[model samples]
Target: MQLVTSVNSHSIAVMLLTVLALFLFTREKIPLETSSLFIIVALTVGFTIFPYEYENKELHSIDFFSGFGHEALIAVCALMIAGQGLVRTGALEPVGRVLSKLWASSPKLSLLLTLIVGATLSAFVNNVPIVILLLPILTAVSIKTKTSASKVLMPMGFATLIGGMSTTIGTSTNLLVVSVAVDMGMRDFGMFDFIFPVLIAGSFAIVYLWLVVPYFIKERRAPLMDTSPRVFTAKLMITEESASKDQALNELILKTDGMMKVLRIHRNSNDMYVLPNSKTIIKAEDMLVVEDTPENLKSYEKILDAVLYSSLGAVDEEHPLLEEEQQIAEVIISQGSKLNNTTLSQSRFLQRHNLIALALHRSGKKTETVLKDIAEISLKIGDVLLIQGKNEHILELKQSRELLVLDATSDLTHTKQAPIAFFIMFGIVAVAALGILPIAISATLGVFLMFLTSCINWKDASNALNTQVILIVVASLALGGALLKTGAASYIAHLFVLSMDGMSTTFMLSGLMLLMAIMTNVVSNNAAAVIGTPIAIGIAQQLNLDPEPFVLAVLFGANMSYATPMAYKTNLLVMTAGGYTFGDFLKVGIPLTFIMWITFSWLLPLLYNI
Candidate 1:
């Protein structure tokens, strides 16, 4: 009786910690990595401070930090590097172009194509990089078609998540399951083990997305009137002391702000020079004609201390400047962008890029407040930036990866190493697929080749990695190990089985899957998998059933974090991009979650013979 009571006490303590971890994860009040680290420390200290005997041994003192070197964890990092190589080489551009052309005519068609392509690529590659690469291209297409970006972007992200579940290499979750199974002396899964079930699930998902998701989602339309207006106009003055005094007016405009137009520069005695080249110099009392909004005019006034002039009275008969010389373009924020959570003023976007934000569009709502003095407006994905700048400067800014240009101009002069990049990418994929090399080895090799071929320099390659993501993965793995070593996982599994006794295997599977889905909503999916895998294995051992189905159920369930915006990284990615409310996910996700649960519960036992 004493032993039973002691066991129960230990189990309760561990379960409480697990619950605490889940609560922290779901709230997103703390970073996932930080939450995981705390869980690990708590478990370690609990075990040491209040030791408990289990199975004739004191509860194992967990070396929670060793999961940093886990092979599955290392492979994920390597895959990220490989994906970076592919992006740097411009190898995916042709694929993106072909996809764009196929879906050019309709929003529905575009969504379907994006789903298909995203699913196919995610099966073999990392989903994170795939989504990152496709996001810009999809945004570009939305601009071209004038379609509400909200309609297709979320579906694209979901497609990648689904696709990642289709193959062993599709996501780290699949690989983690296989690794754990191998460690438990179970038959190792081949590369295509998940192909059949995934095909069925994926097919149903695609059809559902095409037929059902559209009906459920509300269409967020752009304004009928072009709320994106070019309102900023300013005048630039060239003085003897000005940095651009001796520079050509055109060159000076380029160097200063592309959005600022020099209507005319007058030397002494009203000698007006229009669009002067490098030879043009400023004499004393030289007046330069420039056009921008009042706020931008003020910025120019502050930056160059130039005198503000009223808007030029129609440089041409039609407007203030030639149509070819000046125009408006829309720019969208992207993932890993330095601009996320920053304001326009703080970003120095106007001062540095020479573009003025005339208006802002978010979640189908338009704001024309000029955004000059507002410092608290946080930039998010899918926020449209209506910028006014010269045609040449707009093109230059468009070329940058930080912002996706929404204008309808194609500039193909930028050189890209398409063929070499393709070959390198292919080599990496082939090596990993054939099992000739592990993904990490092949991916590292690919990164080196990228440098060798000059496909991407070191700076670009480094930018592709998300350090926070890597740290979260490592920390979660360590925490998961601590839970297992401290006997916390076994304790939870025993209690779950006890409470769920007399239930059918289907009921048990459903319950476990639902529990995992809930846990993932609060914590990292990888952490959920690591902690859940062992408990699932324990449950299977007690039930005298095959562990594969339960393990796969846990893996699949961990990824099905659709009910909350904080559930998965991809969920958060689309939240701001889609202008989604927290309630929005619950509206769409609850049904999807049920569908997946039912599909997997029925399918797992059949496939694995549990």
Candidate 2:
């Protein structure tokens, strides 16, 4: 391709190199960290070879490297730390639990609640953390309801993105675009300055994601929870709030919805075991020996508010057995192991190992046994056990002849601290939204409170900062500066206007939004925002129109990164958990991007009165 002669030869060269960098990124030839570093090095070298001269100020190497110390980068890191605090403390657990219950009863209501709650909270909180908190809950709901995680996950991710587009602190890309605009002599925008336009565009996108996205993508499922697995004994203790309270034995059995079977019941009041009759009634603290299936146990617990008790009765409803560090894993009983010839009660398994067995999976058709007979049933070869313990203990078992650890790894949420953590996040958002404090100051204060309240430790806070994303953001900032200084930004703006020579303002704005949406999906959205904001400002200046609308276009377009797995970080996270492939995103997201483009084009001009 012949370079445009209107731009300086050196500026054209930088644009070519930028295109080459984007090519390498999309091809997945290297990690994002490495690709980001390449941009920093190449920009530094290019500026050193041929510097930009404006009046007397020349673009220097140090200028190219200044993005490493940019304020936007620092603020983004702080937000990540605060979000991590919320995650570790289980701040969103209450919301997740309520939604999971709603989903268990009705998928339609669940989708509606997820969209409303996710969009509203995400408007104030960062979208990444919002998605992080909701991911596990949605996955559990999908498993419990026999729905595909892929069907649920993408909509949740998209809702987070739509909400992120509505506020300045909602995403790093939004912050970057506003920072760029302010640097170009535009006034600093407020947290809610662009909210109206976002809502207008977001409303259209949200409707599509909620009603239409699921039907397009086929169901993707997790293997371990399929119907072929065996069922095991779980001691369920009735709570005061149990839905099965004061119900007949037949009614209680019907309440499990085929997920569990009541084999025997023990009355806490009489300290006596009773064979349950059809007319027998449930009471608080009644212990039921139930057969739990992998697919239905979680749903049953949510429905009844019951607690899983241990065989020794050491743990009751008030005390939790699993520690914070303990996680659940599925392990298979290997041949010739001691467990092959022994029963759990006879073998004293707890005395032998640190991990405690939560449930068991045996092959072949499941057989029903009475509580006494089943609790003492001899184990056979190839039995799968869901064991709960720490990593060290699990690894030790892996080296021995006991069992083979399976691939799946999961942990229980610490829902006890949900209220306090959520209140802290709310305070941070309130102060920032009211302009009571700057976002940076407010977010940093929230992080300190998180530490003081024991929401998260120093180690976890540090780990929350993803170095790869940090490198990418800083590098993109530097590349943006390079484009602006070398006049390539102006060149690109002129090319856009020339392509739409006699068109109306609406067409030009739509062209710009379409360009940004496509580019953001190909590269980093923050990178797209950093480079496009200046060109957008140039377009507005040339046309003698309000620059606010143009700037808003760049902000919204950069967030249209739903079309590819590599388009956004949250997409990468949901991939394995949802069992999603690249093709899955294409099936649902590519067409949606065009819809967003057209929606934004039609709505933005009216919203901004452009």
Runs with alpha carbons beyond 4 Å of true place in candidate 1 = 1-14, 40-62, 105-110, 143-146, 180-187, 222-227, 235-335, 340-350, 358-369, 372-388, 402-415, 573-575
Q: Count the backbone clashes (under 3 Å) in each candidate.
A: 11, 0
Candidate 1 per-residue lDDT over residues 1-610, each given as its tens digit: 0112124566667667767776776653365557766776776677778886755777554655555666776767666666665654556667777766666667577678789999898887777656655665665566567666666766777778788887777887777766655655677666777677777777776777667876778765432114344564544555556665555545655555564555556666566564644456655556676555555655665566455554554232344432346666666665455666688778888778877666676653446445343335788655666677777788777555445555544332223765776787778778877889876677778778878888777667566655556665665665555445556666566778889989888889889999888777666777688778887877787677887788888878887767776666666556544556667677777777777778888888787665
On a 0 to 100 scale, what is the lDDT of residue 69 in model 2? 68
lDDT of each: 0.66, 0.71
Which prediction has the highest TM-score against the true structure? 1
User: Which numbered prediction scores highest in lDDT against the true structure?
Assistant: 2
Q: For candidate 2, lDDT tens digit of each residue in 1-610?
A: 1123278876787788778777766765476778889888888887787777754677777787777667777767778877776666667656767776777688887887898789888887777667766765676566556667787788888788888888888898987898888888898788888787677767777788888888778887633344232343556788888877887878766766544667689899999988978788889989887655434554566667777765445344555333444445445443223565578778776446775555554543253222124436677544555565566676555433133343232222554555677888888888988889877788888888888888777876766777667888888888777777777877787788788999999999988888888998898888788888988987887777888889888888889888887788677555544657778887778877877788778877897787
Candidate 1 global TM-score: 0.78
Clashes of 1: 11
- Model 1 RMSD to the real structure? 7.3
In candidate 2, stretches whose alpha carbon ends up further than 4 angstroms from where it belongs are 1-5, 227-412, 415-418
lDDT of the structure predicted as candidate 2: 0.71
